[model samples]
Target: MKQRLSLIIGIFIVMALSNAIVPVLPEYASEMPALQGIIFSAYFFGAFVMVIPAGVLGDRYGRAPFITAGLLLTLLSGGIILLAANPYAITFARIVEGIGAGLFVSCALSWVNMQPDHTRLSGLYFAGLNAGLIAGLMGTGILNSHFGQNSGVMLFTGLAVIPLLLSFFIRDTTGVLTNVLPPVHAIGWRNKWLYFSSFILVGISGVLVSLYPEFTDESPFILGLLFAAMNGATICASLIAPNISLQPIQTIRLASALVGIAVLLSFIAPAYGGIGGVFVLFMVIGGSIGFVFVSQMNYLAVSEKLQGTAIGLLTAASYGGMAMLPFFSGLLTEVFSYGAAFLVNGILCLLVTVTIARCRCALPE
Candidate 1:
């Protein structure tokens, strides 16, 4: 495989494992129903706290080394999950996993962006990340259906190994040994508007995914399947996005509209249309995933000091959303029903779209 491809594959292993791991928390918590939300949030809590520091470390130490360390942690975490039965044990395992995820994404994306763009190979990295996410979720869900919860952890254990092996194939980038280096202290996060909006966008996506299971009690596996489909569509969107002359913000606006309309439709016809509506929901979800990632990173890539914090905050934003969503959405559902949850997310997402449309310039050529 090509060098970037190998790197992305390693990155994908981490991505998919992390994405798949979250949806399993609810099922795991069934053994102690009182602690579902707390257990679910534990991993993200770790991630939320670690992202900034991890980003700084990755930038200073080099992305590859951090990614290697994180993937190793993921390997260990998966093993712990396979043996864990207690809520406390499971929570600790997930926290380890979260830290691994935070380390992987921030470092991996920085490395990947260095790859030559406007070529077919450039799109592969994004697809690899999203596909890994989709695959992990979908694969885990299907495995859970066939093997049950304990086996689910083992299944991830096997999946986690692919990245570990792939990491070996990843030759260190030249930047890792470069003579010229930016003075780490020279970079600043003064560009508040760009980074903050990007973080919020990440937060909204996390909230939706974290709270999504409550919207449908079908199967925890369904969360994986639905997210898989969503990520599949996200991969497709990334490939097609550059073909159109639309500005990145314009692309985000259009994608947000589709997502809003899809969420609205999914809410109205959630169960009426059966699996088909579930698929549509994911497709819309996927588009939002593509737009948010591509657009936000595009903005942050231009920044210097903000780069590390931007990446760290970007990772933390999702974890923060994860930490808050279970409590907030759970409370909302208690008072207003799950359909209301969809409505609330839809409205907020649309509002962001409107704001972006009103202010930002089109994506640069």
Candidate 2:
């Protein structure tokens, strides 16, 4: 119980510091706006590069060391951002942060899977993630507005120390290192539908992270509130996910539908109800994502022996979508408009939903 508490707190703090900078990053890089997408996606890029290796290493050795290393990297990234004077430096810092996030998440999740009662525990794990994002979005927004970007960056960086310290206390559970690798079939590579659903869910989130700032000319506080509404809804959904029983395919289909509707609504709400409509849609999107995320985690947590590898692949796919899709969405926005990009996302979500449903029918039950 003590270990679980520390892990939860550690993950919450790590995610909070990681996400706190998102809403303010564009403002920090205003001089070269074209690179904003690169900077935003850099973190995920780093995570994508290292997540698989991190998972493999954690499974062989122990998760504790990697968790500590990840926290240290996160602390270093925060410091770099605090002192960075150019977009290049910030991008490097973001990549470093992403690596830290990947290491921490893959290991921490694998650690959680070791515990029993996964349905409830997965909810708690996701709740920590969403809660941290909400804190970061709202807290950083307020701090950035009041103390300027540099100070806000410094403050958030300082907060990383707490998690870094806590990570040292995480119990090492790497027991009986295995020389043999599991069969390829055991890794669930055939579950392409699961991976695709993860990709679409995070792809939409990445687009929102990159483009939502431009949606309204509101103050940072208002913008923060809007993001908070979305993340808050995500927290609620995650906490309730365990109680909402549904088959894996059913959950994916429902989540995909919600995301598609939300994306389509993004185009309409602002036109009719202004920012309020957009805010409502964001909440819907967040809830749907939370549901999808927990459902996937539950599916992967099924095997004690293969859980690490399964989750590693899932993390890689999810972050890959996050890294690439938002950059593409940014290009679309440059060529066309935000609405055009969102419409494309909505269409893609619908298509993916159909594909997953078909895959479900073909896969064994």
Return the top candidate by TM-score.
2
Best by lDDT: 2
- Assess the local accuracy of residue 142 in candidate 1 as a C-alpha lDDT between 0 and 100: 69
lDDT tens digits, residue span 148-266, model 2: 87665677578777767777777865332556664435465566778888888887887886677676566766777877787788888889988977567777887898889888888
User: Ten consecutive residues with minimal summed lDDT in candidate 2?
Assistant: 356-365
What TM-score, computed on C-alpha atoms, does each candidate reach? 0.80, 0.89
Predict model 1's lDDT versus the native. 0.64
Residue runs of model 1 more than 4 Å from their true location after superposition: 19-27, 118-122, 144-148, 168-225, 242-246, 271-278, 302-306, 357-363
Per-residue accuracy of model 1 over 40-87 as CA lDDT, tens digit each: 666777777777777677666667777777778888987887788777
Q: Could you give me the TM-score of model 1 versus the true structure?
A: 0.80
**Model 2, which residues run further than 4 Å from truth?**
23-30, 172-177, 181-188, 215-219, 358-365
True-structure RMSD, every candidate: 3.9, 2.9
